[model samples]
Target chain A: MSEGTVSGAALRILAAGPGVTIQDAGRHGLLRFGVTGAGPMDPLAFALANKVAQVPDGSAALEISMGGVELEAVDAAITLAIAGGNFRVTLDGQAMPSAARLTLEPGSKLSIKAGEEGAWCYLAPCGRIDIPAQLGSLSTHTRSGIGGLQGRALAAGDVLPLAEPKVLPGGAMEIEAPVLKRPGDVIRVLLGPQDDYFNDAEIAAFLNGPWTVSVRSDRMAYFLDGTPLTHAGGFNIVSDGIAHGGIQVPGEGFPVVLMGDRQPTGGYPKIATIIGVDLGRMAQLRPGSVFRFASVSLEEAVAARRAEAAEVVSGWALAPLVRTSLSSEFLLGCRLVDGWVDALAED
Target chain B: MSKPLIEGAIYDAPRFLNSGETALVVEFGRSVEPEISDRVLSLDAAMTALKLPGVRETVPTYRSLMIHYDPLVIDRATLIAQVEEIASRPGTAGGPASRWVLPCCYDPEYGEDVGEIARMTGLSEEKVVSLHSGATFRVYMYGFAPGFCYLGGLPPELAVSRRTRPRPPHPPNMTLIGGGLAIVTTFSMPTGWWLMGRTPERMFSPQREKAFLVAVGDELKFEPVDRDTFLSLDARAAAGEVVARREALS
Candidate 1:
């Protein structure tokens, strides 16, 4: 349908889980004013969702946490894609893969439930989110109550205005969801500006030992629970600006990895920093998930980041979803021309 | 030209701390002082002037400048080499930038810590207000919260430890002091710093043309106003008017 044919464009939330908020690439160049550029926890997944939805590279999307969301199209049919955590997704009543591109007709309900793996999920629509950009971004910094919908988490009865999707939905398509974590996969980190504060024994213990993601984690930072690390020197440092994934060890001796919504500066001594490409992987590790930090050289970290960027530019491989209900009704409903290619056909 | 002057190069040699693949912290010194702050601001200004590709943003702190960049566009070594070259130049840290006379209301209602502070410092409540308002302060940096201004130059007599227990969330624009730093909070947040008063002028406003009112290295002087005046100015400021008076410092 064309833009005018659809009724008022909006998405009405019937139910929402915690930490659900609108996000874009992030607000940049304002950190000097103490504003944090809060964005999606999983940047790669966010980008993939936008790509699958056929939206512009950095269009705003809903960042749903472990607890999922249930919403309905309000007077407009909209095309969308879900990515990130392997969530259980249902469009109207048909169960679909977590990372699938589909359309929600007017009054159709889309439900995303927490599944077997991952923590953060992305729900991207193929249109500009009709929200006023605060300080040049739609990314929500909930701690400061700035940006997004009233600078807070999305809740039931919230109506988000949506613009007409630039590209129309062609057919149901699916892609492999981002692999947030795998068994034995170590999160890589770079040793710090304040590594000297920790003794050799402490450093070894930190790098060699396992640390569980604490339940106290949020968008700001993830607190690690393990043998509390003591400092060889003072716990506090001269306050300095913090970078995303900077691992600050506080007086309490716990390592807090600052994230997308972290404050601009901090006084705690940072012992290590997670490399850029691995930050998303680290963010997706849910509470109680066990992981170890593996130290990587500066050169290696940069190379890894470059490799990921190249992959993003090359684009993801999309596949057609095949339903296998071998009944007469299911056979009759299948679109013969849609995504139907002979197995032996050559390009 | 005489070899480019190295102004505010407090450190004999700066230290480059790699935060990750995406950022580098050029620390000028180990202490918080005007010279160190000057070095941070000067390097920040130089980085801005150069407009180096891949440099996304630069945050100036008390003794270091954190430069965030896109690693793909510019590698760490190249970025550091360029920054080091700029730091080697003479007179990089320019002089004073601006001065502001911000209106504050120290009426007991807003200045909740006035009595407690006066008792601790062995000064009268009026004396405390005068000492705080009369002193000139410098904008060292912004941190901890959005638009929160961390100012230096608190009078020694007025210096006090942070609250033993953090108070409940206070409203935005509340003037606060802890240790040697004076702050004007941009949003309501629980704080251990003593609330000295409240200001009508918005230190950081997303609605205003400039989101942050003052920049690093600027001078600030608090002009105490009556409660009624504070309410009147607060309303206008809320409506997006720049109520705080400012002037360029020559």
Candidate 2:
């Protein structure tokens, strides 16, 4: 944060396609009350978005899923960072690079369109966004409507007020965007809590088959379209608490892989769990996307997520990059109204 | 999961199944029972008392307790070992932590299923409400939705299997008695259960300091209320007025 407090225009959504949400780290320690810990679906990307913009890790960032958003800064100068998916970003008609930081003057128009390769993208600014916290987090559990911008998906006409930008007289910054592996046919999982329900042959079938992500998918769970994972006997277990990524095989024979917005407990037998590191990848793939599940050891799963945190200290960088002004005719529209930053700075 | 010998009904040890790299589900048995719930609660209480690092949170259900932790701080092996050590000791049977008496209005306007239950049992609607409100039921566990409780202790006369066709968009704060089971839904989620009455008390509110009104080990008994009373209390609840009637468990 600089010594100068630049109070300016908040963000207004001229249009929001679908599944746009505000997410941060997460809301933890509330599972006993049946509240699922709502957080960013792509946690690694969420963290990097904060880092790229030089904001706190838990700062609120937009989680836009397979959608487009038209936004404009109401007033003030704010720096921005965008990441995740191979999303197409344009500022007032000029293309913007992914994971690059730049300043947005008042009325600066920014647009994000979902790319073919990914389903979700993140838009982060250098300063923290001001939003009411629910259950200790700003992340929205869309199903439960539990937090973030009134606990619902962002639609047209929603205005988001942000705190002042903390740019240190910087030019431009670039963050190392981890190469998101969108293997059309390979997702690693750790077999689990009810894996005993499946026999050797069933386990083999699960490992061998490629399941297509069904249209019936959301933050709660993903219904995969493939040969159902076999349950040797009754698929019922004594009702128990379920975890994120729990692959529960119900009577229907298909596996319902639970995610961030899942209920606290379930009764179906869970044969496996998708490793945490792979969840971001899983979240980015759209329905009809085919994928295969490969079994990983728990040691392998834990090590992969831990490896990311280990990188946070030195693994991330703030490289020097040049930021360019977009093709902005709106600047003149506002400048004619005598709302230029230069005039304000002189005052 | 292994079954215990009939002669030795008590659990000697819990089978701690790995939910994922970061969680473990400690299963006591294969069925729902008060004692199974007791063991689950006791294990949760004990493990939480230990305050092991990286222990994120827990969700206790009918027969198991799921422990969510940070694998970076505490590996799965060490966490399993810690829980295994705790489970080997004599289990503490936790009693009801608190008691609440909720007012339920079974009038037709509120009791969508009361007539159905009365007709099915050859009893009056009055009898259905009395049977529901007469006995004290313990909260076995909390799940399905935030503050949606799975309660036990419905008498046989009131027993009815859950509806084969689930009703979509069921109202929240409704008291539902089904197949000798009961629950007060906190969210307007779909349910196949038989709804017998409505409660004015909002058990789940996001803005409250403690969002959940009851816990897994709490006990609640329903008292029948007239429609006028129901409306009054409901209005107060809607206005963010204090509603749940609570007392310390003896």
Candidate 3:
């Protein structure tokens, strides 16, 4: 069958989950063609789900927000994984962990209930979800009505194709479980290139003020409500390329944190950008959650990221012996015996 | 051809940030202006044509063109120099220009605020529609929405401010006026522009071989079509039967 031809298998959308859509890495560098990269708000969640399912790094996955999606698997035997936010999951009436791999038979009914905590959840199948790539991405850009399920939210009776399974020798390996905790609303930021556009008082207010995440938040941006920061300069500025996490202060004065699907450029003055490490925390923030910006140096941010990476490498190094029964004394004795055998063989 | 030296034109070297660890933004100006957009697009086309080393992609906007590169392959300064070289080159003096005739329907169902626009412009609803359809417009830029064309010409009588309060939902293919100019949107967007009419034509089609029907510096003329003509044209466009007609600027 041609790509994007929906396999006879159909997944019924029982709840039409809130903010759920198909997402890949995103449509990249197509803004000159007037396209925005609409991808997963939490890249970590999407990546983790793909990893857990043993799928390719950039395969398309269901990005369900605050979960209300209910579906029954159709004509394919598949392994599925869920990651990111904490959401209740049930498979054929049995409860399942949020971030574990599950092998389901064809026609298995899966339901993801409303999430008690966190904002986004990701579901990835072992084989890639067959969706047409537009401008080189399978992600849905709802604002532009392009790519993924007719460029709109998934409705009932929308059938999606799952790629043919190629099982690996060991199936999927389980990683160390993350210690779940409530997300703090404190967002760490670094002063932006245009930080000087605001006065010292405005900057102080921006960092110290309690800003509420407005109800008007979405994949494009999170508009904050708080003390309207007053800048010495006027509202208009030379339009500039906007990076993700760039805090745009529109005429309204409240800052809007541009997210994954943001316009490539903007004319608004930006005060600062929330650091990349803190973006995951920002993604899970619920509307009306109060937040304060804590300024940090770029060096500190880089160090934090490096430390996180080191922890992952170290954890992987210890994975082989995680469930092994050999004690330190037994291992030492085995090593000694091996050394003796080596010397005898040399003789 | 000799390169024209544009005095007082400012240029900046490209810079990188670790937001995605791969994407670098090449900023040109601090504010929004036609000149900045033109310069950015010129550089964008040149760099795209050159296929610079380590550059995966580039996005040109109103002021800056963001170049996404593989950090594993290229360093910051090298990418900046490549973009600067393209920007400094004088190939084409201005941006690309084209002529397109867009069909519009002034039916009240589509133009919900035609009476309001008439009230503001001191013209009858028919006069408002006629004056809008009477002249050709130059495409200033494509912005606010994908494939949406911001046209630069409007008869002075129909040059009206945007609505005092924005409507909840504006239909797609809306011809609007604001800040002494008319705009033809290819996508659905909330706007303060004076709602005059709607077109059945889809300005943006991601599935199409050429996704965007209009581009920057294109000349656009509005052809008055009734409901039947709008439906037929829309169907033809969707069926991929209609070819965009381009006429030389007289």
Best by TM-score: 1
Q: What lDDT does model 1 reach? A: 0.83
- For residues B1-250, write the lDDT of model 2, one tens digit per residue: 4422342254556777878788888877766578878888988999778989999898888778999988999988898888887777877875887888998888888798899989889999888888889978888877777778788888889998778788887777998887567888887888888888999987788767667888888889988889999999999987876576888977
**Model 2 chain B: worst 10 consecutive residues (lDDT sum):** B1-10
Assess each prediction's global lDDT (C-alpha) against the native: 0.83, 0.78, 0.68
lDDT head-to-head 2 vs 3, winner: 2
lDDT of 2: 0.78
**Pairs with backbone N, CA or C atoms under 3 Å apart (clashes), candidate 1:** B4-B90, B5-B90, B5-B91, B6-B90, B6-B91, B7-B91
Q: Pull out the clashing pairs in model 2.
A: A9-A74, A9-A75, B160-B179
Q: Which sections of candidate 1 miss by over 4 Å? A: A1-8, A166-170, A177-185, A323-347, B1-10
True contacts kept of each: 0.78, 0.74, 0.30
Better of 1 and 2 by TM-score: 1
How is the predicted docking of candidate 2 categorized under the CAPRI scheme?
medium
Score candidate 3 by DockQ. 0.30
**Candidate 3 per-residue C-alpha lDDT over A1-347 given as tens digits, one digit per residue, 9 for 90 to 100:** 11122244434465666578999988875665557777888776677677666677778988887746877667644567777677777765556555555544455567776566678778887676776787788898888877788888776677777766432222123334442233557888877646666888899999987998899999889999998988666766644556667788877789999887787666677778776556767887878888899988756765655544444334221121123376754543343222323455677
The lDDT-based order of candidates, best leading, equals 1, 2, 3
Per-residue lDDT tens digits of candidate 3, residues B52-94? 7778777665556767665546765677777667766774536
Model 1: chain B TM-score vs. truth?
0.92
